[model samples]
Each structure stands twice: as C-alpha cells, then as structure tokens.
Target: MVKKKIQVLFEDEHYIAATKPSDLLVHPFKARSQDRRSLLRSLKKQTDLYLFPIHRLDKPVSGVVLFAKSKEATRLMKEQWNSENVSKHYIAMVKGVTETEGVYDFPIKTDKGLQEAKTSFKTLTSNDEYSLVDIEIFTGRQHQIRKHFSRRMHNLVGDTKYGHSSINNIFRKDYKFYRIFLHSYQLRFIHPFTKEEVIISSPVTEDCIHIANDLFQFDLTNIGNEAKEN
Candidate 1:
C-alpha cells in the first residue's frame, strides 16, 4: 500500500506545520525499522531535516501539528505555548445541543494532580441529535477538550474513550463516521524568531467533513477561511 503525503500548512526557516491525519502518531514510542507510521518520521523523510515536535494531537484526533526545525527554535516556540502567547482553536461535534457560547473552566486531572484548564466554546449549528461547536482552549492539558466536554455530557461524536456509545453507534451506522469528531483547526502565536504574529489554520479532514455535512447539513470548505477571519 502507498502512504499518503502529509499536507504542509506553513513552513519557514524555524518551523514547519502540517495537517496530521487521524490514527497517525506525532512521535514514535521507540525508534525501529518498521515503525514508519508516525508524522514526525514522515516529515523528516519528506524534508530531510531533523524535526522537533512542538505540540501534540492524540492519535485519534486530526489537525494542525507543528515542528521546530532546530533546538533553539523549539525552545522559543515552547515558551510561547507555555505562556498566554499562544491561541489554539478546535471544531468538534458533540452529542447534545450546546449553548450559544460558554466557558468550561474546570480543572483536569493530570500526573501533577488537578491542573487549571479552561475550554470555551460557541455553537455554530445544531439539530435534535447533536451540535457543531467552535472551541478555544486556554490550557494545553492532555485530553482537556475531550474530558471537559464529556464531563458535561456533551461528549464528542465517535470518541470511544469519553463519548456516548449510543450516539457513536448512530453515527457509525447512519453517517459512516468512525473517528473522533475533534479537530485543531487554528493556531496563532508570535513568531519567536521573526517577532511577527503568525496564524495557521488547517482545514477540516475529509472524514469529518463528510460526517458533519451528513449529520449537520454544513459545509466545511470555508473552515480555514473562517479561522483566518476570526
């Protein structure tokens, strides 16, 4: 079987960002000859440069993933991510009709104990079964978005770990959806080297687009444009 090339979103001397497909790891657990499915590995082969992973999206989720071209670049970018200088946005399909806009400032359980996490969302559209939401996350805790929404019973569609089984079944059968309905659509930060603001957006994946349109009667082609305008 032939592997599909990962789509590059933004690239420069310091950083390279790409749209990560669902089921691909950002980094490998261990280096080996057969472990060829990771995004980091593929990007390295594609660009012939040693890439440093800047952030992560779970293997089951799809969207923007960034890498720094050098260690110095990595440190500077990580500083922005660790502080309030970064903005991350996502789009998700949840099991229930959500409010027009709201913030989930609940703390998430981590290895260090409960850490502060804030996830704010706006309902883009909805139906009797589910809703499409635009989300902004303030903290980069692991599984923060999934946990926050699931805690409120607004579980993301197709999220087996923290989702509604009945709704997952419905989408699996009716909409042919099989992956978690969460996407990191936009990322904005100050370029640590260039000293200019940079905004990068990844378009919704085809699988998510198909299910979203089928379930919500929405078109996802303008997703990137929407992120840029906002």
Candidate 2:
C-alpha cells in the first residue's frame, strides 16, 4: 500500500523523518510541473503545523528526510546539523567495481560558507561489472557525493549530469530506471525535543534494488535491507 510505502522512520513532538520516494523533489526549483507536489504541501497534509527542513536531499535522491514542527524546533535542528551533531549515511550503485572500503576525502563549499566533506564508501557486492556501495558523509554539502565520486572515471550509475550516456542508458533503456542511484540510507542525530540520540535508517526503493539484483548481482536482503521501503 502507498501508506506503508510513505513511512516516517522517526517522529517526535518537534520533528519527523520521512523516507522520501525516488524522483520526488524535496522542494520546488526552476520550472514547476503540473504533477509537482511541494514537500511542504505534502507535510502539511500529514499535519497542519508549520514544517521546516533540517537538510535537503536532491530531487532524484531518496531516503530519510527531516522536517521541523515549529520555528523553535526548526532552529534547534538546524544548529544540530551544522555543528556536525548529525551523521549521514547513504548507499550507492556505481558504474564499475570499487574497493572493499575507502574514503572520499573531498572538500565542498556553499554560497554562505565552506565545509570539509568526508565521504566513506565500501563495496558491498559485485558482479565483476558493477558494484553496490555503502557511503557515509561526515559533512553536509550540496551534491558532494554526486560530484566528488563522479570525478572523470566511470560515474555513478544513472547519473546523467556526471555520467556517460552509454552507462546511464544501461539503466534507463535496459532497466527502465530513470532516477539516480542514490539513497539516504541512514541518519543519526539528537532529538530536538527529548534530547535523546536517534539513528534512523531506510531501505532502497524497489526499482533500485531490482536493478542492482538484475545487473550487478546485488541481493535485496543485504544487512540494512530491512529498512523501510521507499
């Protein structure tokens, strides 16, 4: 059911973490579409109170998304994220075989300021052609993983901006996967209201898992596979 598919991994008096669907925009940008349902609108239907975002994941990316219930909670959550009190983790399906484990030591900046981003990754499964990766981010930056990991060599599978047409076509045409191969697999942070630490994780969407299983031999029942379905 769509009810179970749209799940809230974490929720409290002040905040909530909803595992987002792939290809859904976190917020509206550039041109608006008839099919577009702004994130705020969706959250509003969940509740009438004001909602705010602690951090934003890209439109094509899927997984744990945080929202604030009030102005005070919003500010507190933002502070926690900026202070590195929150830990971010993700899963990626890349173009080629990768190492068993490695760190993506890259730096990124935004208009307001700059921050050092550390992306740690490891190969979970491989078919000698493609690979499944578990990646973690020590700092938050826009497109940090998508850009740094995609430097020149074979890019992230289905990454149209940083990948080759041939590889993207493998997922698009062959597998009918249009969304990028990225998932916000986990989030760890202190609750704004209770001050208790929470570590929430999410499962990859069905389509993504099927693609990995079919092309890369990645089984859907990996260690973190039981996380809520996207």
Q: Pick the candidate with the highest lDDT.
A: 1
Model 2: lowest-lDDT 10 consecutive positions: 221-230
The backbone clash count of each candidate, in order, is 0, 0
lDDT of each: 0.87, 0.75
Per-prediction TM-score: 0.92, 0.86
Best by TM-score: 1
**What digit string (tens of lDDT, one per residue) describes model 1 on residues 1-230?**
88789888888899999989888888885566355579999999988989999989988889989999999999998877956788999999998889999999989997678999999999999999799999999889989999999999899988999987888898788877788999999998888977788888998888888877877789876786544322
Per-residue alpha-carbon lDDT of model 2 for 1-230, expressed as tens digits? 36433577767777777878875677665484665665656766776657787778877888889888888988888777845677888888887778888887766665556767788887888776678888888778888888767762637887777777887786788878887888887888877677667778787778877887787666654534443322
At residue 175, give the lDDT of candidate 2: 79
Candidate 2 lDDT at 150 equals: 78
What's model 2's TM-score?
0.86
Q: Which RMSD values do the candidates have, in order? A: 2.5, 3.3
